[model samples]
Target chain A: MNEADVIAALRALATHPAARGLRDDAAVIDVPLGRRLVATHDVLVEGVHYTPACPAGDVAWKLVATNLSDLAAMGATPLGMLLGLTLAREAVWTADFIAGLGRVAALWDCPLLGGDTVSGPAVLGLTALGAAAAPLSRMGARVGDELWLSGTVGDAGLGLRMALGEMAVEGVLLKRYRRPVPRLGLGAALAGVASAAMDVSDGLLIDAARLGEASGVGVAIELDAVPLSDAVRALLPAGEAGVLAAAASGDDYELLFTAAPAAAGAVRAAGAAGKVAVTRIGRVLAGAGLRLRGADGPVALPARLGFEHGRGCNAG
Target chain B: MNEADVIAALRALATHPAARGLRDDAAVIDVPLGRRLVATHDVLVEGVHYTPACPAGDVAWKLVATNLSDLAAMGATPLGMLLGLTLAREAVWTADFIAGLGRVAALWDCPLLGGDTVSGPAVLGLTALGAAAAPLSRMGARVGDELWLSGTVGDAGLGLRMALGEMAVEGVLLKRYRRPVPRLGLGAALAGVASAAMDVSDGLLIDAARLGEASGVGVAIELDAVPLSDAVRALLPAGEAGVLAAAASGDDYELLFTAAPAAAGAVRAAGAAGKVAVTRIGRVLAGAGLRLRGADGPVALPARLGFEHGRGCNAG
Candidate 1:
């Protein structure tokens, strides 16, 4: 299909009242009373963000999911999203991509509001709008705050290796790489309890350093306490180096939060309610920078922390 | 500069409290009481949207202006915007682009919210947010309502020709094609008076047809009454064909609206208050489709309405 036909298909999927049947130039919706609106935008390019051979549906799903993850980190409830699709001339690919987008949007209850479509290389962008009564921030973590993590990290990195044919593993690892679930419930639960929070998109160590830098504190992470999925353990060596590598991997999409030690029970309760695993991984210190420790002693930080795109480095 | 360096420069420009100094995962802002929020997203690819020789600042300016124009069409007040910049590996180009974006954003009083940036082929996307008391819509036009236009049309089309070296003229036309002023003031003025309204990004006739079609009515455009800019008039032939071609050209970015004949005085007053010229170029009819009338009689519709991208037709 051409741009017009693809737009027609998108219009059919955008049934929300705010969409105005995709006829209006903009979507107008009432922001709930006394709630602050959260907004985030992310872009996914064809080769840089995803493999060209990756399913178009997965690409679309990732586009929406990644943007929504930003909202989740803010402890916000997603309302809707606007898509910016620069498409190639492929009818089947476009249909599949839209189908995936509709499926994910419906699953998350985030409506498709409005967007613009144009002809170009495959570059998909999504801007998610959400609302929160009291949003969390990375600047609020104080010294002596306990650092917590929800869900395991580095599975996606392993999954990416498998997807790229560098490894020969299958099952949950591949799924983790292709589809990441946003921790929206846990984030909302952490809104009042957690002092500071953010999702780990880059490596955990790098993101931890960033969190500490933002809050004007330091982080001392017990490497052994860093959660790792069973799949990752089964594939990698059972040693400190293996755990460190996982900690330095990207695409985790797990929430890393900090709260006072007195709020541990409440954090556990919130984690239980959200049906996510909660692990105490570290503690905030009075100074800046990050320190990693294993069962024996402190380990020196790696030269490279995490993925840094546009700097001639691998994103995965 | 790398992504981090670019972000540092952007952080200085993002002064809104909601921006959180671009440190948080997303920006959170409180919506004012009793107001609906308007959202719109648009993308501008490097090659497809503008010529490679075009200034990066102009490209950035047009990107924000065009998206703001969508908000203007809805009669919404500009608030903030999120940028999704997939940049090429050119430090100078990136700096120039961001400088232009910051300039336009500050000029329009729209704050820079948090957004994501990555390395890839240059594809710029922006999601603009606005607020409205009672936003206008294109579905509100009634039959017999007079169609009105703010400012003259076809200047951008002529400007594009000049930019492409098809014309010898240099001054206003090129500026029109490069930097369009979104008729936000006029649109806001007509909010309660106009029955239906939209901005003409595509050609006047095509966009008018869209407004009419959305309202389930037909439009009768008098070719002689259609307003033309002095630049367009001086460059084109003095006949029906010249007017037709001008009306069929794209990138006008003028306001096309409908109001009851009885409300014409109010419409004129609103236009004058907004410091824009208002002209009656057509009228809403009972049925569907568009009718073009010349000095002699009714002229048949052209084979092609306007620029249709990615359909093997010239957008210029």
Candidate 2:
């Protein structure tokens, strides 16, 4: 389909009143009173972010999921999103992408607002808006806080391996890579509770280091304590080094956060309320860098912490 | 520069407190009570929306300006914006692009919010947020409303010709093409006065037709009444056909609005207050579609209305 035809197809999916029937130059929304608005933008490219063989529907899902993960990290409720889609010359791909976008938007209750569409290499950008009574920030972590993580960390990495044909394409691991879920419920429950928080996109170690840097503290993560799915443990190498490798793999999309030791009970309760698994990974220290520890003691940090753009590391 | 270096450079430009030093996953801002929020997103790709030869700085400027123009059409005040930049492998171009983005953000009082950047084919996407007490809509026009335009309609078209080497590269017309100004002040002044409003990014005739379609009315435009810059008039072909061509050209970034005839004085006063020239070029009729008239009789419509994406028509 051409740009107009694709847009016409998308118009059917924009059911929210704020979308203005996808006719206006922009979308108009009445933000709720007394709530602080949180905004985030994320871009996903074709070859760099996802493999060419990946389904367009999966690409669309990951694009929206990753962006919503940002809002989740902020402990915000999803409101709406604008999509900037640069499509390749594939009509069927465009249709599948829009269908996937609509599906995720409806599932997350983040209605589609308005955005521009263009023709070019496949690069999709989403700007998500949310509302929070008290949003969490990475800078809010304290020196003595306990670090926590939700969900398995390395399934997505194993899924990536399976996608690369290095392993069997099992449903669980492959799903982790193709359709990772954003932890919005747990994040919202953590509002005003967690000292600092962020979702792990570029691997646990790198993202943890970022949280530490933002909070002006240091993180010491126990490698063995890092959560891993049975599929990942079965498929990947065993031991602390394997755990560390999993920690350094990207596209986890799980929440890595810190809270005071006193709030551990509250954190556990919030996790229970959200029906998500919670694990204590490590503690915040009074320093400036990320430290990795194993059962034997302090382990040497890896040469590469996690994925960095242009360094052959994919983002979500 | 790599992605980290580019993000660090952009950090210096993100002086807004809401940006959280560009460290957090998202930016948090409090929208004032009782005001509606307006948002728009646009993407500019290399060799599509703009020529590869265009300065990265100008590309950045036009990207922000065009999104802001959408807000302007809604009579909104600029709040802040998030930028999703997919960069080509050029450090100097990245630096210049960020500099241009920072300049325009400061000039328009729109702060730089947090966004994601990746390395890929250069595609720039911006999502602008704004606030309006009474946002205008294109569905408000009534029969007999006068269609008014702010600023000259054909200058940007002439400027595009200059950029394309079809004419002399004069500063005035070239600047119009490179850095078309958003009529924010005039739009804000017409908040409650304009029956219907939109910006002319596409050709005036095509955009007017869209306004007519949106408002459920027809537009009757007088070819001679369309405003043209002195430079455009001198350099381009002359007389009725020339005016028609100019009206059919795109990227004007001028406001096209309609108001009751009784509000003409108010419209003039608003234009004067905003320091923008206002001219009446058409009227809304109780029918559908657009009608163009010349001095002698009715004029035939052009085969092509205006620029549409993927049709080899450049937007920026």
Candidate 3:
């Protein structure tokens, strides 16, 4: 069925008397006597996010990781997740998938409570729920807040490119694509330290622009300051490739946040304590547009943007 | 990719130190205030759940409804949800899909929070979250508990079969499949009343069998007492089709709960007050096996079971 029909069917079912107008970025559960819950969901389809050749365990791990990445963006701690698994009539593959999920859940302390299973084309959809101290949102940044990005960017995009045979990578970047690390603890710790934040699933520039849009502020990013992993640097065509890589690729899953200038030291301290890297990449400005500074001068920003699923397939 | 690779890709994400294993039916979130959040996810593939001609709005509505139905089965209250949207590259259809979801979320009060969008071979996934009262589960029913079902059965099944040209229907039943009612409030009300509960999704008999297995008990369903909609009754082949429809058809989304005889009155009162039908059609016993009475002695149950996606495209 077309999306329209499907949405209609869903709407008809989800419409309970008290749950009306609950369609927002997160569902609002009114806790009568306890803490509120923050929940998020995401799905990765085959031939879209990964390939048939990718290990099934890797795919399962990525599904949970990606959703947790969203919770990390919100500065929420991992609660648990439910998996909706679709197998292609292969019992062996399904067992491995579950085992893979079990391993990571054990490592992350993310337990599998329950979910549904069905046979179909191979695809994995995971819904992760986390507890919020004070629900972190992408729309809470303030002007003049120091913009920070945790960990390096563009590795996953490069990793995917390598898998697609468009680039050659010998090490970590490929691993980055296969397994992108989400800055979970760093993000959660930033809950009080940062004014606004979100994960960078889309490339940095685009996601920054979105953060700015959501926060009603402008951002000025120093192109040279953005963190680039050595792996990403080695595979790029040139130094300018950093900007290109950061701007046009996807799957970074890093946390791009804005904090008060005074809070930078404390934020970095927390990151260091957690063994996660935090870097200053830009600053939130009281303007209307995003400006990128370069080595020569203000170069024309790339007209093309980050991944948009079906829309950006031909972008590169 | 195999399930292993998929799991690997998912598990490699940044993790919180306290996150428990996240590969389960419900995500357990520590609210820090003595409140635990239980989360679950669901997806309905096109041409698998409904005909491709079904409206996109309906599909969107169904996606939320189905997940909410899960929460209802757990005796949980609505919280919020995340949407994983995969557009078909058709702007018109995508707009309609969003609109329908908007309507449902607005009506249900469960806002669509953060979700990922991708372009793919056309699939829709929605993960919904809800608050649990005391961790209701499918494995808590005791032997000798009375098995009760809310509302009529066989309507959605009959409607689906009718859509496939395998049967005939008059009214309501067709609408039931098009938009099955999820008894969220009623289900939540039964949290303290029912011993074990689950939604009637994979046919009454199969799901009842599941509940039985989960509780280490047996179920004896009185076919003569099973409630059926007038549409179902009118379409059934005289004599035995009524029982078959009740046992074999699915998509009812009604609550199948087992409660002690002492709690039956409260359940009946709650059901009536909630404006839903409550029917007692079976009882839990201390053994294993499902038995159904027929017009002439106990007849052998249908050898064919409930719908299993990808099994037979022509299966009714």
Candidate 4:
């Protein structure tokens, strides 16, 4: 996420026992006294994620943000972070990359901590540490909670399009992809407000369906209300194309939440306090399927949705 | 370091406010008020560090150990870690790679936490999180602090030669390269006792010179007393080839440390408790230089030495 949006979005996280203000070396956390910890790891490779043409500094910044986004999806507060950097062993770029990371990490208050350095292969790997308070897992959303999204959506996806010259947009959407603002604050704020929550790294509609499957429920979204930034709007030919693209494109890094109807006000208030926009997109239902209520009535959803680990998008 | 040594080493870390043990999903750290954090990162690419034919699992295990090894040298307790994994999307050995890492992480007690997973290339990136103790640095050693090594040295260096089939030795030397032991416990144990301490990933003599430069001191090493494992000795050619090779080769992962003479007993005790050997390899002296005393008077040290990030090493 862009530094400003990330700062703004993270600022919404109220002080809690585990994660306080995003202002220390690492997020302090308290876990249950005796349970074997469950930890899973993933890594992103450069050129595979973004082109080398992208700024090295942003590459460093985005790497840290991506890892933190995972922790947010898992309902964990960051404890600390480590980085594994592989560059060409060229003095100039490596130094710049580290300096950029140092600056961004300082802004977020997450210290670099420690990691290994090696030559060969140009890649950057980051490991983020986070603790769960009754982890609000991808498998926990209920059948009746209303579906909600914190802040805008599809900005990063569109931003990437603009970066690649595939689409042209103005304002935030382009900025979103180049730099995503991770909703760490919104994630922590959702702890007591939502039944289940996850960050939208994959496309929202697709991720929503996955969440539904995980929770053994179905989801229905009202296309009219899906939050789309002006940047996403600028990319399409002004109608269904824009809406559909926004719905299926990923990398928003927003907190998608399912909460009881009664808690809607609180969720909105929480989102607003951090100046993040909250939108009611859909509802979780009893059956096991995903439905979209577009302007043309019910329509079949795209099966190839969201980002898969090894597989590229079906659209590509 | 391999899974076993990593477990043994991490288990030996003294009780701390941050790390609970090597068994949690994420390390629970207690950060003090005020003061920001400082962090660094690096990643090792396969074929660059070891052959692709190397056991994939051991390679995975070593990745975490190497990163954690850095934290140990920095005097930072285990905080959290991240992994950036890249593998051929269809590698037959991918599952084995992940499983080996899971096993070692389970033993080390650090959780997998969060990271990015990408397709393309075949490499492993690991980042280790650690709580920083301010004024904690490589530059902490001073003039006159007796230099010490946590355990018997050169086995890994010797192990490398054996791995390359260049040396026809047997016993621990092979395992040495395949499974270097990270001196986590000894390094952590030296936290208070050592004025300056570092894990010897590079050879003893080279790393010693680095410590001296960082601490603004000179160094004098006694060739006769450098500890050598029985496993290493059994495989070495008669004379000083093994000793000389061990002194210059990297990948030892031992803790090379310096302390005031009064702390010698404690340093030795720490090593004993960790089950690693310790020896009076050298002493920090005035001015800036390194001197090695052998039977033939002060022998000329290697003109250029150690593993530089980009420069090719005989071990690599």
Candidate 5:
């Protein structure tokens, strides 16, 4: 099909009520009066974010997922998504990409609004709009708050290694890398239960440190208590070194949140409500900066905490 | 300084209250109870939409303005903007780009809500959010509605030729190409005045055709009535051919709208309130498509309407 046909295909998939059948230049949306609008944008570049060899469908999934993760971090429910897809000259790629977008959008229950598509090297940009009565932020943690993680860290990191053929052992790790589930349900459940919250996309340690800095408190993550997937445990060491690698790896789209000790039962109840595993991995302290503690004593921090663009980390 | 420093500099410029210091992952906004949110996104590729020779600041301005233009077309008041800037590996380029964004954002009164930036060939994507209780759409024109235009057409198109060192004549054309003023005020004023509305972005003739098609009405334009600046009169031939050329040229960020005969005075009043030059170019008639009416009689339509992606048009 031609570019117009491709665009028509996309319009077919993006059937939001306010999108006006993708005929208008813009979309008009109405949020409920009581809820505040939460908006986030993220860009995914082809060689930098995902390998060229990566399937187009997976790339589409990841592009939307990453932005939704930001919304989830704020404990917001997604309202709609707008996309700016700059694609290379390949018809098959575009067709596959649309298919992927359709599947993932349906899966996540996120309806696509309208956006621009043009000829360029692959760089997918998306803006996700969400709504929450009391949207959470990074600066809400207090001293004595217990830090919790929704899922095992570094599974996606290991998935990346597998995708690159650097590591062979696999048990749903590559899928983790390709299809990240934004912690929307867990985040919504943790809203009133948790004091502070954020998604762990750029590795646990770095995100935790950012949370600590935002709240003007110190963070102390226990290396021994850091949860690991069964696949990660089979592949890496059992203790401090293994958890360190996990903590420093990016692409874990899980909730890393904090709640008061008095709300421990409520936290577990919220976790049960969201149907995601929650583990206590750290605590908020009175001092400043991040402190890593082993079973014995304070452990030395790594040179790089997690992935920042152009840093030592290159997962894709 | 470094990349983080560049980001910090951008953080200084994008100071929307909803942005929360650009420290959080998302921006949370509370809209007025009655307003419906209007959202639009557009992407501009470096070598395609612009040139490497083009100043990064101008690129930044054009990027934000184009998206804001879409918002203006809907009779919406801008709420905020989110940017996704993909820059080449040059600190100077990034610094200049951010400066341009700051200037344009401030000029438009559209505050920046934070977004992502990464290393790639420059592909600037921006989302502009606006609010209007009863937003205008492209389908409201009736049979007897008069078509009106704001400002002059084709100045920016001529400006493109000048920027490419093709044409010799000068005066505000280059500025028009470099800095497009979105018809935000006029659009805001036209909220209840215009029956149908849209910005003339991809050329006057093509955009008129689109409006006609959307409203299921035929548009008959008197080429002689299309407004032209004195600078354009000095450079181009008089009457039909020159006006046709201007009509088929793109990059005019003017508003093209329709108003019923009964509301003519109201439309003029709205234009006066918005402080923009408004001209009655044509009227909506029965049937479909666009018809060009000259001083003598109806003129033949052009083979190609206007700039579509991958067409003969390549301004940069």
Candidate 6:
């Protein structure tokens, strides 16, 4: 089997009319009238993004989820996705990836519009297109807004540790690492409610810091308030160190956003509508940089904030 | 020095307001109100798409042009571009690529919307977005329509050979190989007038065959009517073989389309407006395959139609 086989599988999955049955080189989408188009692209390499132990389907899921997560951050409803796949000559792997792609194509209701494929190393490229009338920007956070997170922090990072055998794992940590759920519904719910929002791909603390920098405000995170899953709480290291581990670890794919304090009830309502838990972990402050607080007093910042790709996650 | 530096450089290039200063994870574009959004993606590996002899800037240009070429085929005017660049740990190469990208970003008037980059092999990915009120498709050709081609074919394929030291060469053939222009204006003009439209990225004959297949029609090419550049004409292999060679080469990025006989004048006028030469080289027929002819009689099909990436270019 070759790339043609892979494309045939994708074409079968691309059911939207905009896909043009994958016959046309480009996908033609009727932009919803008066809506702003939201677009994001992300690249994931094999070893860097996933371990060899990770399943092929999971890799496919992560690729789709991670990109849509960007759209989710912008409060955009996903319209379509385009993939640029560079694969090694492995047919079974390609077949499995296609199957995994089909699963997410339905799960998100995001059509596989069309894309280009070539033979090379395992570097995958994905672009997600979404639309929103009142899109939220990271630069829109206000000075007195409260910071919220959609899910518990550091689960995926812990899952990564489990996948790498650095820790003996029980529960679905590995699954969490492999198949992240993009908060599409929650994002759409937060569209007009949130002051600013972004997906937490690089870790909670670092992303919050970025939000603060973008909005020209300061961030103060209460370590006690950083929620941890039961499984993670049980398996974590020590007290302050463990909390830092949770907040600083990346790959969470949670929605980290800011909204006015008076809008807390509305924010919670939006969260309930999306069926995702919303936690207020911090608040926006005047000035710059990040501050951490424990019950005793202000805690010291971690030397390393999060798992940055060493460059601009912002562009992604 | 790192990814932040790269993002900072890209932020400088992305002047479009939709880019949101590259601070957000995704771009928010106002999709021209009512136009259909056209999107296409292409992937180019170092050895597969270019050689060491090809300049870094040319690769960047080719990446942008090839993706835009797909939009050109759909008769869509370009809007913006997103790049996914995976580079080896060479700063100079990265800087050069960014420079080249900036050049084409201005040359095409397509803003650097935003994209993701990572450290890996020398693989490049690009997505070009455009909009059209009445986009043409490969499947829209009708029988009796005259086939039109913009610019000479086989120049880029020959340029590739020269770049690889397979043949001695002079003139702008190498430039043609490095950076073929996308027919943006011509595609826009042909949007409603042409029955069907597509770009010839593969050899003209194979692409014509594809057009025929997609539209459920037959394509008949008159070999003698095929155009060649003066430089290529002087240096072509020989006889019917040279003409076949010219038509069977790929990477021309020329428009190969179909229009009604009555629209010939309009098509020529569109070509004049686009500042690109247009040639009538064939006709759409009632059957379902491709046929070729010379001054004397029929010409046999070549073993290979064009430079296919050995998989589903149809997806592209």
TM-score top scorer: 5
Categorize the docking of model 2. Answer: medium
> Which 10 successive residues of model 6 chain A have the least lDDT summed?
A307-316
A174-262, model 3: which lDDT tens digit per residue? 77777766677887688678888788876788788878877889988888888887777866766666666666677778888888999
By lDDT, the best candidate is 2
Q: Is the docking of candidate 6 incorrect, acceptable, medium or high quality?
A: medium
Off by over 4 Å in 1: A309-316, B309-316
Q: Which of candidates 1 and 6 reaches a greater lDDT?
A: 1
Each candidate's B-chain TM-score, in sequence, is 0.96, 0.97, 0.85, 0.83, 0.97, 0.96
Better of 1 and 2 by DockQ: 2
lDDT of prediction 3: 0.68
Worst 10 residues of 1 chain B by lDDT: B307-316
Off by over 4 Å in 5: A169-171, A310-315, B309-314
- Better structure of 5 and 6 per TM-score: 5
Select the stronger candidate by DockQ from 2 and 3. 2
The local distance difference test score of each candidate is 0.87, 0.88, 0.68, 0.64, 0.86, 0.86
Q: Which prediction has more favorable DockQ, 3 or 4?
A: 4
Q: Lowest-lDDT window of 10 residues in candidate 5 chain A? A: A307-316
Question: Per-residue lDDT tens digits of candidate 4, residues B130-223?
Answer: 5444313456778778888766777777767777778785656777677665666666567677787777776787788777876778989888
Query: Model 2: clashing residue pairs?
Result: none
Looking at candidate 6, what is the lDDT of residue A156? 79
Model 2: per-residue Cα lDDT at residue A7: 86
The true-versus-predicted C-alpha distance at residue A181 of model 2, in Å, is 0.4
Per-residue C-alpha lDDT of model 2 across residues B157-239, encoded as one tens digit per residue: 88888888887788998898889898889988998899999999889989999999999999999998999988889876888
Clashing pairs in 6: A311-B3, A311-B4
Q: Model 5, A145-172: lDDT tens per residue?
A: 9999998888999998987789894759
